[model samples]
Target: MSALSQLDRGVAPIETGMLPRPFVVRSRREELADCVTLELAALDGEPLAFEAGQFTMLYVHGIGEVAISISGDTAKPDSLIQTVRAVGAVSQAICGLAEGARVGVRGPLGNSWPVERAVGKHLMIVAGGLGLAPVRPIIYWALANRDRLKSVDIVYGTRAPDQILFARQLLGLSAADGVRVGITVDLADQDWSGQVGVVTDLIPSMLRDPDETVAMVCGPEIMMRFSGQALVGAGVPAEETFLSMERNMKCGIGWCGHCQLGPHLICRDGPVFAYPAVRDLMSVWEL
Candidate 1:
């Protein structure tokens, strides 16, 4: 997920940019074998107002910090929610935090999806694996503003049926009016009844009007590249389709050059960008 071009949303908390605020873990839910979703409340009683798609740097005491996207409802700013997959030392520490555990938080930072631009236009959200965590905020925003938009289509693909995140919620969303949810897994077992294929295979079916659709896609680099191409091939304007980029970010802000991608910094210029903005760079091998 990314942010708006300008940092004028006033979405950041009251604390200074570089400082971390005290937040207590209010709840934790296990989403997978190594993934957990945590809800945190600020100890100072201040709400971290954030735009959908922005992320935060979560710091576990005696451990370290890692950037994770906000995965809660934007309407509820007082409680911060983030889903963590225990892939690294810092992330594992975050995933292991128990209820009432205290942690340091910096941000609610970076750009957001240009959701307002999708108003009066059909919106499509696509995600793969944990990419859903970053793009989940947009789904919440779209559902809240359903009347303002034409339609909402969500296409998600993961490795297996057991790997699905927010399964019950996704089931309920499929029944919501004006919303279409299509889920697929790369492989399936005897108990699975859903489609089995890459996410792109389901894209054309969910799209109502290709030219009038605005898409937001987040996944691995190759998946996003193909998705962008598919959207353009189906008649959506390249500029109207956005993809979130990820890199090895040391500093959530752009101070460190670890996240540089050619001329752009993944942490600053984007984590989200229109397809045209990153199309060429994405084609390069490990640039």
Candidate 2:
């Protein structure tokens, strides 16, 4: 995720510019064999304030920087929480950092989800694998104010049971706040009991009027494309749906061409965009 400068939109601006600040790891929790969530405290002791869906530039001292989303509740401004999967050299370095390790924190960056647009509308959050991390803050926000909508449905798919993020919390949240929770896995073990298929298979069962629903999708690019097709096939308008896209980001700022996707720069223009605006672009090969 990338951020427009605080000087631009007032929504949830971080300190302006690309300069990195220091934050100490308060604690870290292993969510899966390859994933961990870090609770960070600013050297100044302030909570990391940001909007839902925004991300930060986390820099490991001897390593480098990588853009990762803020996965903690937006309601909690006193703590910065980021869940990361160990996928590369930088990520591995950050994940391996011990308690009390210090790292540079650049931002609460990028465009956030269209939470404002979804007000009074029923919500459908579709996520695949760790894509749940990007949408987690939005889930927390909507659930915190559950009465403002008709319903909130979460559809998540992973490779298997053990790879699900926030499995324990999803159970409790499902029973409260009238939120409907659905899970599916592409591959399952003998212990798995839920639906077994693609994440899009759960769409038609959502039942809300397509016009009254606002869908938020984030996952593998191909999975998102299929999810978009299913939701639209089920009646949701393309413009009302949003997708959080991921790309190879070199500079969190748009100066570098690294994250370019046609005319839009994924880092600056969005990690979040209305489906209609990006449907064609996302279909481009290797985008």
Question: For each candidate, what is the lDDT?
Answer: 0.89, 0.87
Which stretches of candidate 2 lie above 4 Å from their native place?
1-16
Candidate 1 collision pairs: 2-111, 2-112, 3-111, 3-112, 4-112
Among all candidates shown, the one with the greatest lDDT = 1
Clashes of 2: 4
Q: Tens digits of per-residue lDDT for model 2 on 1-287? A: 33454446664443445677899999999999989999999998767789998988899987899999999999898889999999999999989987899999987778999887778988999999989999999899888778887889999988988888989987567656789999999888999888999898888887488888999999999999999989888889888889998888877777677888888888788889889878898788986
Report model 1's TM-score to 2 decimal places. Answer: 0.93
TM-score of 2: 0.93
Screening candidate 2 with a backbone cut-off below 3 angstroms (N, C-alpha, C), the clashing residue pairs are 2-110, 3-109, 3-110, 47-78
Q: Going through the candidates in order, what is the number of backbone clashes in each?
A: 5, 4
